[model samples]
Target: MATSNGFGPRALRYLESARNLVGCAGGAVGLGLHFAGLGGVWWPGVVAGLYGVGALLTPAPKPRPPLPPRPEPRPEPQPLPPEVSAPPAPKPEPVPAPEPAPAPDPELVALAAYLDTVPLPPSAGVDGLLAALRAAGPGPVAERIVRHRLPVAVAGYLRARTWQPWAGPDDPDPAVQLGREVDRLAGELA
Candidate 1:
């Protein structure tokens, strides 16, 4: 029988029970007729046996219904009219030019000149080198040293002045190295 909410497992069970009952009634009627002499015993037995076998072999339950078709996705919405569209692109601001580096210190210039007069090994002593550095003052010269733009020999001479415990007499003399750096710097400057 049809149902308002569609046939369910309970309906299937009831139908299966009814099918079994019909098979049993048919078998009983065939036996009763045979006993009453309406048909031969073998004939009725055969009919009842066929009915019972058919009932046993027949499938009762149905397969589940196929899953519902999936809904198709909607397309993306189109852009709005120009009047309601995004604001006009912003103008790019101008970037300022970088400042030029300051000219080299005048004292450093004069120190290079003085170094030119001094011979190799700096007979004037370490005090003379210190004096030249003092004349150049600390600011610009220190910046050059920090940046490592100074010649390697000059850098080595400056480092030697710090007199770490590791430094020894066997190390190349700072004066000789300084002389080489002076020659290089003077040639470049000239």
Candidate 2:
């Protein structure tokens, strides 16, 4: 028997076999001796019988078949050339510029310029302007200017102008300043 921790490759192969021939042989010899009525051999016979039964109870090792050789890889296919070059894309047409806005009504422009000259108390607010325009007299032009909403800055300037006392003739008139703004806006419309 091989010693523990020192088994050769052959010893390993023997262990892997399904049937333990050495144990079977030992059992057969033991049985023969027992049948021959040999004295003082019963213990060895029993041991051998048990060993053979244990070996028979053990499962067999399965044998693995050798793997087949791998096949050579195939070459990749080359890309085919385009049959013909594609036609060039069409260019987009240029868009026409929008026509200038129509000029503002002359009457509205004149009314805005006229309203710019009107002076009132600071407390008047925009309502005061509207009231003044109404008091000026009932006309299509006055009505239009009264109905039109003044820009915030223009309204604020008008209100501030009301708070200041009448300036010297040398100083610039607030009305004239306001009229200039109106002209500028009217020019833009034109």
Candidate 3:
């Protein structure tokens, strides 16, 4: 049914659905028209303000009541014979306790954390560390990486993040240098 204004209920609802978008578009159009000598300089603002006011003045849409849940059709109970009994349910199997993981090496953990914060690719980061450990069996090579390479990589990463006054102008990008160092460590370990 059309209102006193001639807009049907559906048309009103459609407009109401996106009042803000309509208002902004109206404001833009009004501004363009004003510039083309159609209305006063206040036309755009008025158009936008009128929309806002209309939005505020309009009644909120009424929420529809929830649908009633469908009643499940239950089977009618039959009379049980006097002698029959229901079987007892089987007991559930007990779940085994999960084994705890070994504590990670402190240096490895620290290096992984730093790597995670930086933009270095996976192969240049923790994967490299794991690869080196696998190749070298964690003897001298692990010591060198843990004591030297990791610290240098972490320091380089930190330096890359901040302005470096002392860094030589010719130094390679930190990420490249870090990747190189990891590759070298893996090779040496291998």
Question: Model-by-model lDDT, in order?
Answer: 0.59, 0.58, 0.67
Q: Which residue pairs clash in candidate 3?
A: none
Residue range 1-190, candidate 1, lDDT tens digits: 6666655876777656746666776677776777787757486675578568756765675778999999999999999799899887999898898986566656455546654664435542433544454444457554463234343555566577567457876887667667656555434333
Best by TM-score: 3
Candidates' RMSD to native:
25.5, 28.5, 12.4
lDDT of model 2 at position 46: 74
Considering lDDT, which of the candidate structures 1 and 2 is the better prediction for this target?
Answer: 1
lDDT ranking from best to worst? 3, 1, 2
Which candidate ranks first by lDDT, i.e. highest? 3
C-alpha-based local distance difference test score of model 2: 0.58
Q: Which lDDT tens digits does candidate 2 get at residues 1-190?
A: 6556555766887765656765566567666666777726466757577568767776766768889989999999765557665666899899998986655555445655765675633442434444454445545555445445345436756765776576565766665565555544333333
Candidate 1: where is the Cα deviation over 4 Å? 1-155
Q: Please state the error at residue 105 of candidate 1 in Å.
A: 4.9
lDDT (C-alpha) at residue 15 in model 1 = 56
Off-target runs (Cα >4 Å) in candidate 3 are 1-106, 122-126, 134-136, 164-171
